[model samples]
Target: MTRPNRPVSTVRLAGRPTQRSALRRATQIAMALSGFLLWVAWHRGLMRCDTHRAADRFAEVLQRLGTTFVKLGQHLSLRADILAPDAQEALASLQANVAPFPPEQAVQEVEAALGRPWQQVFARFDMHALAAASIAQIHRAALPDGTEVVVKIRRPGAAEQAETDMRILRRIVLVMQGLVPSLRRWGLAAIVDEVAANFRYEMDLSREAASVRRFADAWRGSADIVIPDVVDGLCTPTVMVQQFSHGAHLHGLPSSTAVAAAGKLVDSYVAQIFRDGFFHGDPHPGNVFVMDDGRICLHDFGIVGRVDGNMRRALVAFALAFVEQDAEWVVDAWLDLGLLGDGTDRAVFVPVVRALVADCAQRPLKDWSLSGALAQLVAAGRTQEVRLPRDLLVLTRTLLLLEGTVRLLAPEFSIIEAISRHTTTGVFDEPKSAASQRLPYELGNAAHALPSLLARRLHSVLRQGDLLQLSIKPDARMLSGIDRLGRRVALALVTLGLYIASSLLMQHGVGPRWGDMPVLALLGYALAIRFTFSIARSRG
Candidate 1:
């Protein structure tokens, strides 16, 4: 497959803006933002106010700012570590339903991308947009061979406009940092850079097409999922053509069908995160459709998340810690995952996260919410100066959107249950039963071989008459360090084994019952938590 040219750096300026034009744009943005801030202050200071209303007005201002700021708002919505819940909710509206440019401009973009007249490219191309967003708009079209497809066209001058906006934003961030030195700790510059990079990546439609292909390959043998096939040779940086999927939106499905489809949707996402380490970052209701046969169809691959191996392990550990309700383990896993900032106060951060997890764990299984707990944890991070990983933030955003979508389909559906089921089956990692069962046997074999090996070494030393002359001097601190390392490693292994066994017992419905969970499993979890606590203490 052909790939479009990838830019060396997304933040690179497309073309230098004239001094007058730059000044004018900057002045316009400053005036709009100042007005909005003043309105917010007046409304909150002098009249009845709520975050929701303020958030809505904030989103409106961003929408009015044009594509770059709209995209920024959508990006900001994903930062659970930065924005409050209401602000995130309001900013999410920027994801879709943006005003579109003229059809003539869309047509012009298609022609330019394809290097041919619009008439020569398709048998029928609808001038009307199927959907429109800040960066692009979609048009329903058919190839000369009668194959139905959708053409996604980038708005005219989107790249140049994004470049200019990003430059202004970067300068603004610098100015803010200079004025308020404390703001530098928040890494505003890094945030702006990330936004610019993401916008640039989305601008290249070819990358989105490639993402769709990868997802299709990942789910090739799955029966319950459908990824639209890309129209090869028709994809370009500005234009992407893929088979138009036919299905009802999730909201249109019956409750029964919606529940089943939601399960499959959850399963697919779990596999994407744990098995594939790649996931659809933006899975809002608009991008999800349920086919007549109940297969879930995903559209618009513009935003996707890629997790590395270490991050996947960290996430799996996090899930394990969550299920076990071991707050210390949760904090440890997060810290191990490098989610903490340099100046993070563990004394404060740990207690906040612990309280959040305990509250979530105390809820009834049917009422449990993974997304809510995660959101709270991220919000805590913001207050405690903990920096969540970018991939993690994206995952949180996916789960938040997924939860909303699932709730719309099946109000009583428990994401916690789905995640627990997958965890029990070892979809996120190695099978707990198999690993727990095999570990002891492997350790026994090693133990059985150690005596003979040690005896032989001693006999050799004696035969050489060097046994008495052999004097071993070990550093006290080194030995202490080794001992601590060994103890922690052993504790981790035992705790993991216990947790796995507990999950197995729960899965097979073994032992007595404790509110739907096996009693033995519950005990096992308790023991695992105790061991985790011991490990944490040892670290101190």
Candidate 2:
């Protein structure tokens, strides 16, 4: 097949700022205003200092800051593994509802994005918004073809503002990384980077449309889920057209039905995250509704979670470990994901793991302190020099959101029970009718034996020299290079420790140290120098 060769333009020329840049600038201004508000709230005694309901105030602050900060808060709420429970609870209360932009402005945005007059696009377009949030607002419209649908239009300047907020957020995160040594180990900076990347993709409606299609394909045969088809040729980075649905939100269902629905939702969430590994990251009540036909209608495809084949396979083991409360297996899974300290004392980690498992097991399924336990373990691990992967934080975030929604809808639903049920049938054993009659131990044995058999056969083949092999020879220079790299790594660690200790001394009055403590301002410059020299020496 012959393909046409296209001319490539490599000249770097400054052009008009993109819509994304404008949106970012707006967001930065909004964030600055938000920070000022926070200062005013603190200085004027507007912020209540009450110990109780403190979480509510925190959520309010985020909400008042606008969409980007609220979303940031929502993201933070997921890391109950890092945040205090009350703080997480407060942040989680910042729902995805904000005042709607005016109908006149809404029309302008829609017209601007579509590059046509509103009348040309729709037979009847409602001026009043159906709902509104941080980034976009919704309007009911009937297409010229007479297909009734809802149009979701990105708020004017939203992209630019979001980009700006993200930049501000990145700056804040970088400062935190430099100032708080503990935060670096928690992978906070990497998390912000991931969020920034996702936000960029999310700002494009075409990308969101593709995500919807992918989701639909993944759940083609499922009757319990409803994914709307995108109105092709009409979608753009600023606007999306999709089938409109009318149904009661999940929170309004009957208690029993809601509990059942909650169970099913949890099942769906876990299956999507661990089994399929491609899931809607935003699953709040606002993004879900229960149709008359009993199917769950999921909306909002801006943020999502994904796991490759390797992570997917590891998740099966993680689920199994959670089911059995096996600390060793869980740690192994964490290690597989690069979520543990390389030089951590295994003995120290075991006690912490044991404590965490015991804490979770002691609580009721609906009340399980999984986040608290994970948070404690994570905090303790940091004390022993552990590092967690960015994905683990994302996983923890998803679990927190899932568990919170479940608790709100059904307090009696046990996460442990739900997980055990799924592990036995969904992951460990093949599904069967009346499967409750089967012994779990028997299923587990069967599952284990297959892998054991495969391992033995592979060992026999290796013993008989049936497998090909290769060996590499290393020269003296290579050995010297390896030794030098190791020494530089050791030096970097020592420098990091000194810099960290000095930072703490300068920030807080934490007893006197041997040498005069340097200013926190100088620590960052010192770290950059140390890191650069270490790398340069290693390369030399």
TM-score of each: 0.72, 0.65
| Worst-scoring 10-residue span by lDDT in model 1 | 3-12
Task: Kindly report which residue stretches of model 2 are placed more than 4 angstroms away from their true locations once superposed.
Answer: 1-66, 80-82, 95-98, 168-192, 340-345, 360-376, 382-390, 424-540
Evaluate all candidate structures by whole-model CA lDDT and list the values in order.
0.81, 0.69
TM-score, predicted candidate 1 vs. hidden true structure: 0.72
Top TM-score: which candidate number?
A: 1
Any idea what lDDT model 2 has?
A: 0.69
Query: What does candidate 1's lDDT look like per residue over 432-533, in tens digits?
Result: 456788999999998999999999999999899987685768899879999999989998999999999999998999989979989999999999999999
Clashes of each: 0, 8
